[model samples]
Target: MSLSIKQQLIAQLDRILSAKLEALAASITSTQESRDSDTKSSAGDKFETSREMAQIELNNLENQAEKTARMLNELKQIKTTSTATIGYGSIVNTNHGTYFLSIPYGKLQLDGTTYYVISMASPIGQ
Candidate 1:
């Protein structure tokens, strides 16, 4: 049998989330390198401020990476074969548009079809 719309959407989401995780990790790495390189310079208030900002940026990137990883894990756990109802894993066709029930991940287009990936808790989804 062919893959369901839910399955196609899940595959697309996985690709998107994995790309985000990669970008975030690369950013974190670059930030750390910058922070470390700054330490070789002479000590001064400006140097301190630069290091502080880099640290904050690194921390933020790390946090975002963690969240993205968590989201990826959650997405993997979702079964894409279910379309019995307008709930999680459900790919619904409404008059206005199509919706893939899950996290509020914004718009996605696959195979000439547009889908709004949304969470059940959202007003539009509810």
Candidate 2:
């Protein structure tokens, strides 16, 4: 049995998300180290400025991590098999067009046939 297009997409997204999350984690760690070092050497205005910058960076990383996590959850919720409704992860086929539920990437093979990869937000996908 071949993996569905949706499954392939989810796998790709998962890989991307995991790498992103790892990078974010590394950023958080580096930020923490900088904050610690600045606090030890600086005082008054300089210390406050460094602290604020670090906090802002941390917040941004947190927000991005949250957004990525939500996207992953949404992908996980997508139904693999549907009669013909277009939704996230739906390999849609219509009289007017055909689309695979995938990230905007190159050709993908499923069951020995090539599919045009398209993200859920693509013009043809919507």
Q: Which residue pairs in candidate 1 have backbone atoms (N, alpha carbon, C) closer than 3 angstroms, thus clashing?
A: none
Global lDDT of each model? 0.82, 0.69
> How many clashing residue pairs, candidate 1?
0
Steric clashes per prediction: 0, 0
Once fitted onto the true fold, the runs of candidate 2 whose alpha carbons sit more than 4 angstroms away are 1-3, 40-43, 93-126
Question: Could you give candidate 1's per-residue lDDT for residues 1-126 as a string of tens digits?
Answer: 134666777888999999999999999999999999986456688899999999999999999898888877877877756444556767777899988777778899998988888878888889
Name model 1 segments beyond 4 Å from true. Answer: 1-3, 40-43
Cα error, candidate 1, residue 123 (Å)? 1.6
TM-score of each: 0.87, 0.67
